[model samples]
Target chain A: MERCGLYLGCNIPLKAPDIEQSMRKVFPALGIEIVDLDGFSCCPAWGTAPSFDIDTWLVVAGRNIAIAEMKGVDLMTGCNSCFGVLSEAKHMIEEHPEKKAMVQEKLAKINKTYEGKTKVYHIAHILYKEIGLEKIRKSMKYKLDGFKIAIQPGCHILWPTKVMEVTEKNPFYPTMLKELCEALGAEAPYYSRLEYCCGMGALRSTDQEKSFLLVKEKLLSMKEEIDPDMIVTTCSSCYLQLDGAQKILKERGEIDFTIPVLYYTQLLALCMGFDAKEVASISEIPREEIIEKIQSEERAQ
Target chain B: MQVETVNLTQKDRKAVLAQMIEKGGGNLTKCIQCGACASVCPVAITGLPLYCKRLFRFLQTGHLEEILDDASSWACVACNRCTEICPRGVDPFHVVFAFRRIQAQELAIPASATTSLMNFYTTGHAVYGDASELRQKVGLDPVPPSTLKYPEALKELQTLLDESPMAELGLF
Candidate 1:
């Protein structure tokens, strides 16, 4: 079994425990060992720390990376912001020795040192790369049974591709997230707005009305095209944005749809014969209906 | 569209753009103003002028004030779609960040952004509260293994920030 440090950034560990539960429940079944990463700090988040102070961003990110290095393993996270900011810091430190020195000085206070060699992995990419299609398919109990899923890979997983360890070769038209769903026996159809932002993070925080406008466009587009039974995404941010904002839009009468959302791991866990109550228990958005849909194998083509 | 004039002689040209470029704006002049960044911007699609293409063009021409009040900059989700689509390697997402930081430095940041930053400062996280009730429902250790669970780690994070500009800025 391959082993790696599980880096649970702020969002999943606190606000969305479901994602963390899903990761813990799913990885072991697939032969991936998740180390505790004891004493790990936050990824510092992009909008909050990284946006305001670059120096503070690197030191905090470096400290997290240093934990995995201490354990002699690579790092993996369910958060796109964590992956983006940490990976960006890793890139900056690698490219500039002076920046590395500054980070090293701060790390010295905490009695840790980051060699900057530990590669950061988003859960989706590593699962696709390390586990392979055959293993993922073999581990499934229900095989998704031809369920149609709308995919949102989130934004960070794609951009600043220079620093990202795993990125789509053709980011404009990505098939990685789609292909993973397909391997699990689901039909992930492509829509025109597949590349659009979900207006989470800074947008949603700054102006709800303006942010809703962007989510409204995506909801309307997805409702018109494909009309999939459910939504699945890799990053926690997209999961929160698309899942939460869709409900917000519906309440405001901005859209007339109710497609359920789940992390790819939660979906995989259900397919792997794990109890629905265990795998998807901590979800904030209503998922019981999606559970029934997955079991029934009825979807609009 | 009547283009408004930004008189170059009246402003110190390089001061604003230099800071932007330093903060990962990339080379603003490299932007071709092809509207590619605007085309992919989610906020732009909603009829807002939050176009990276225009932001760069304005920066290229020393018109920082032109795009300052536009709602798109605040509405930027930092999704990096514009940066991904850029042909000239100009990362508009970074430009948006530079603008947000400028706003943050001026203490014009929205309350929600400030709240998240404050949480990050105090708990070493953006979202922190007594979620032990929910965590127990998920069979978790109530607090997980982050700074909230370990006070010393939180202190270490505070120490790092105390030495950085975040302390003096008071945005967090």
Candidate 2:
């Protein structure tokens, strides 16, 4: 089995451990061994370290990459922000010796050195590219036959393709997530606002009303066009925002319908016959119906 | 909304853009005002006036101080659509971040950001929420295999941050 260092940036491990549980359940079943990157810190998140100082950002990110380097494995994360920021840091450290020196100097204090060897990948990329859809389909215990899913690929995984390790051939139209869902027999249909931001990170934190406007519009487009069974996202922040926004919109009476949201791993866990309560149940919106539907199929080995 | 007139002769305006370019926004000089970045920017789609296109225009014209306290840059999610679609390769996202850095240097950051910064130093998680119960419910270790579970590692992270320029900010 191929091995990778599982780098759980802040959210999935803390606020949304169910997503972590899903990842734990899904990867092992897919024949990928999860090597925990012990002592990993946050990807240092853009708003915090990055906004303050780029050097600080690179050092913190380098320290995380350094842990994986000691393990001699590539780092894989479910967080698009972690995947993006760490990937960018790796790129910057690789391209600029001065920046690498700065990072190395700070890292020497911690007794760690990052030679910029580790590659960062989002879980979607690993599932799509490294694992291959054919192996994924074979490993699934249940298929999402006829179930329609609206995908939110999340922005960080797609853009500034120059820095990102995993990118869609046409980022304007991302199909990696869609095709991965199809491996489970689900029809991952395209909606008009598929590429629209979910207004998660800094947008949601800065102005809720303005952020909600973007999510509201995206939700409306999803509701009107495809009307899928659920929404699946690649980013934890997007997963939280898209899932939580539905409840906020319902309470505000802005949107009449609700679409349950899941990080792609949670969806994959359910397809792999893991208990939904463990891997998929923690959410603002109830996913019982979707869970029941997927489990309704005959169990496969 | 009242229209505030910009003083074009203000010498600090060019310095403001220069600092931004120096702070990871090297492509700030490449913007052509074509609005291609704006076309796909989340800030624009959400109807923010100081979106990339306008922000670039404002910077190009040396109107930095006027927009210093605007808080529009804080609203960026860093989607990088502006970086992808910009015809001139301006990398509008980096410019936006550089502007944010400028705001941060001036202590014009939002209070929430201050809180997150403090949290990052203390706990290494910017958006930390106690999920011990959740992790228990999910049949995993309550403390994840991160800085939280390792005090020495957390100290290592703290030392790295402490030695960096952020320590100069005194937020930690």
Candidate 3:
């Protein structure tokens, strides 16, 4: 069995455990072994902004990459923030000799070093590359004929464009996830603000009121215009901000909609004919609607 | 609280100003002090006392201490709101990032609260401790420790890092 290191950054383990479970169950079915890296920590959230210590951030991120390197497989992550930090750090080591030296010097105490040996890939990149969309199409057990889904490509996944291996300015830059959804037979809604940020980055940490306001704007617009049956995201942070903030918004009498938020993996698992219990276990969203949809389809068949 | 006074010589201020110009694309000098960046700044709108225009003025005048010391500098969401609305095309996001880099280099990290973020970079997994312990703490199922399956690959990585002089420095 071919193994790939699965890099699960902070939020997925604590806040969104179902995402981790879905990836574990589904990737193996797709012919990829999910391996873990010990002694790895956060990507320090984002890049080491000037106010933050560069060496510490680099060492912290470098150590994680080093752990993956220690395992000898390309690092695959589910979190966009983790992807961004690891990818950028890997790229920095590859591109700049001095920065690599500086970061390595700091890692020496921990007996770790980043020699730019491991390549970092997000789960979307892996699904699109390793388990090709055509293969995913062949694995689909159920077709999502009536479901309309909206794609929200969080900023970390899209920005600094080259790292993501997609065209940022274009509407279809994050086509892989959308394609995966379509291959499983769901309608992918194209909205005007599809490429806009969820504004859930540092905003959630520093200025939450502003963060919720941004979430409210995005969710309201997504509901009013696109009218997706569900909002599917790859980033765990985006999942929390969208799913958690929606409840907060409804409680405050701001909006009266409950658009289910799902990780792409859960949707894929459901389409692959996994049990609703297993699907619900891996999804933060309630599986009632999806279960009912599948059952109704079964009766029609 | 009284605002702390900053003292800098003309040469010192000019040097820092030149560095900011070179690193930030010379946009910091183009501010007409119009307050346009401030008027549109989202953080300022939230009543946080953070103004990109004021930050630019501080950079130009070499009064970076106040800007560097303030927690508001790190609060920028990189939303590009100010950058998009700036008539001068000044990229406040880049400015904020550059300032953040400077702060990180100076080792002035705040020490008020601990965040789980620290655990993310050290272990590829985010939470600290073993998977079972973390699972119990967070009320999740215990996941087995997932390591890379290939031993030869790990050996090669160790050799590569071992060859570099910087790796021997052991700063981490």
TM-score versus the correct structure, for each prediction:
0.92, 0.96, 0.76
* CAPRI verdict (incorrect, acceptable, medium, high) for model 2: medium
- Candidate 3 per-residue C-alpha lDDT over A1-301 given as tens digits, one digit per residue, 9 for 90 to 100: 2688888876777556666777877899999988787634556565332224344455566877888787888788888878877765666566678878977776665577668777788888788778888888887777778788987767566655444443334423557667867877788877766655565656666667877877887888889887888888888778878888888888888998878888888778777776545444533345577556754556332
Please say which candidate is ahead in lDDT: 1 or 2: 2
Candidate 1 lDDT score at position B1: 95
Whole-model lDDT, model 2: 0.87
The C-alpha stretches of model 2 lying farther than 4 A from their native spots are A297-301, B1-13
Best-to-worst ranking by lDDT: 2, 1, 3
Q: Which stretches of candidate 1 lie over 4 Å from their true place?
A: A293-301, B1-9, B21-26, B64-71
The local lDDT score (0 to 100) that residue A51 gets in candidate 1 is: 69
Q: Mind giving the per-residue lDDT tens digits that candidate 2 earns over A1-301?
A: 2989999999899889999989998887888899999998889898988897888888889999999999999989999888888987888888899999988887887789788878888889899988999999987888888889999999889988998777899999999999998988989888899999989889888889999999999999999999999999889988989989889999999999999998899988888888988998789988898788778745454
For model 1, residues A175-260, the per-residue Cα lDDT tens digits are 89999999977788889888777778777876777777777777777779989888898888888888888887778777776888
> How far does residue B109 in candidate 3 sit from its true spot (Å)?
6.9
* Candidate 3 chain A lDDT trough over 10 residues, lowest sum: A47-56
CA error at residue A190 for candidate 1, angstroms: 1.4
Candidate order by DockQ, highest to lowest?
2, 1, 3
TM-score of structure candidate 3: 0.76
Using TM-score, give the best candidate's number: 2
